[model samples]
Target: MTAPQQGSDAKSNDSSSFVTFSLAEETYAIDVLQVQEVLKVTEIAPVPGVPNYILGIINLRGDVVTVIDGRRRMGLPDQAPTDQSRIVIIDVDNQNVGILVDSVAEVVQIPSKSIDPAPAVGNDQSSRFILGVYSSSDGLTILISLEKLLSDEEWELVRNI
Candidate 1:
């Protein structure tokens, strides 16, 4: 089924919106524009020969979406799935990919001024995906760059899927 862009028309004309979610006890976020939909944990059919980060694929309506274990992708210790687990569908290069988050948090608006460049954390691949960090009363939230999340080889694999 086609993912509905719920409340899609309500996006702002000036400010930026982000969909926050938890991963490995830390809060993270992605641009709202890239979010297609949010779904509960569903049965995934594992595909062989793929990276460990890729758990498998799930059939959403008629479309098959690749599911990525967000924790594993971030090099965090593996945790069993729970009731609050959610698959956040996002558009990466126009393709929808599911990020398995521990729990999805509420969306928030962070103006350009509030977004600070991510400090260098060596040259790790995961660190490269961090766009910036936002601070508020709730504490620090890391913003992820979905565009750079996967490497070219990984993207090529996704492309050939």
Candidate 2:
């Protein structure tokens, strides 16, 4: 999909608008339409028999939202956040979940010209989660394929619950 264009008022933009955030030293972004809200770091209840990367569930406004440790999912060593951690609440496959990010960054307008297709080389699993790379003044933002990121098996489990 091509990046969306914007008018004078930003709020009226299309679903392609993206909210960027930081994880470790790298930057990433997801379609703004996919993001429900951004929340502060909160307690998560552990779920047994689930993957370790799945950091359990969080209670958000009376709704149980699964929390995923993004760093762990990327094969990075875990480190406790020091006042900079944030939870980006996103809806994937009709399920609301919180992705633990290092910090929340600004929402940027990534034109179609700035986004490049995901590289076919390197780790296949990682590539599957990425949709494209958006170049910006700050740095490159890895645009995530939210639908694909939560694989079919995972979505089925969440849906069944």
Candidate 3:
């Protein structure tokens, strides 16, 4: 959660830049400013006493970053890492954490007007984390809130680590 790239409210802007990524079979996005880096699937050192979503830790240069199994966090079925697998480093609160995504897609600029609330699609609980749906030339992209990626209790646990 680095202070510089705290996730902001996307609903308040006329236009927003999002870094899109793929998870499971769906496409998703987050504020571009919140993204610190995107890395390929790399070796992660496991941490004890953490939840299942935590894959492990990675030493980024000198900083130790906590890697999260984003699919698990979002309640999606787990799949083995492939060549397209990526670790998206996001800044939330004042710490930087890594979200393991299936693939890192292109960045997209979407107008706020084109974004709408998440629809009740088959009662998917993971949809709770989705902030809105952005309509683009390709299709609709689900926009997520990075700050809301982890719960308060989860944040506390990460802070302790």
Candidate 4:
């Protein structure tokens, strides 16, 4: 699987590239390989009846892509989008998905040995999505696995939208 390959690649290379972003004041990151692109806040056409985290859809070169609010997905209270807000397009389940973040931070190389397993303290819902925790110069950045971010049922809902 890609997750294991990603780990092995990190171990072999000594570091892995990650695209970092802010969500609810905490820094979080995802493997650079999964990132398609990053965009500024755009007008997202809201879809009815989907989960609250599913912000809506956007036209990306004629492709309708679902955008998810990272904060809402993490069970955090909603906040107003600011000038720094961004939409990070990533590949999930072989489909392109966008994750809205407070801001898109610079990509950085994190050492494989610096990554710690996800702590057991968080609630199950939150912990499941966390791949690991890396202590960086800025602070701790939680690495997320998009594949685990949603369940089969949830992916079905997103697919239907």
TM-score of each: 0.87, 0.83, 0.86, 0.88
Candidate 1 residues 1-161, lDDT tens each? 23446664434323478999998889999999999999999999998888888999999888889999998888788998899999999988778899999999998888677788998883475688899999999999999998778655765686545
lDDT of 1 at 4: 41
**Model 3's lDDT to the true fold?**
0.84
Candidate 3 segments exceeding 4 Å error: 1-13, 122-124
**Candidate 4 Cα errors over 4 Å, as ranges:** 1-13
Which model is ahead, 1 or 3, in terms of TM-score?
1
lDDT of 4 by residue, 1-161 (tens): 13445435535657789999998888999999999999999999999888888989999999999998898888777898999999999987788989999999889888788899999867676788999999856789999988888664876767746
The lDDT values for all models are: 0.85, 0.79, 0.84, 0.87
Q: Which stretches of candidate 2 lie over 4 Å from their true place?
A: 1-15, 158-161
Worst 10 residues of 3 by lDDT: 1-10
- Per-residue lDDT for 25 in model 1? 85
What is the C-alpha lDDT profile of model 2 across 6-116, one tens digit per residue?
Answer: 443444442357898877788888899889998889888988878777888888888888888887766656878658899899997788988888999877777666679
Q: Model 3: per-residue lDDT, tens digit, 1-161?
A: 22333565645455778999999888999999999999998999999888888999999999999999888888889999999999999988778899999999888878778889887773364776888898767877889887667765865777546
Give me candidate 2's TM-score against the actual structure.
0.83
Q: Which structure among the candidates has the greatest TM-score?
A: 4
Clash pairs (backbone) in predicted model 1: 1-61, 1-62
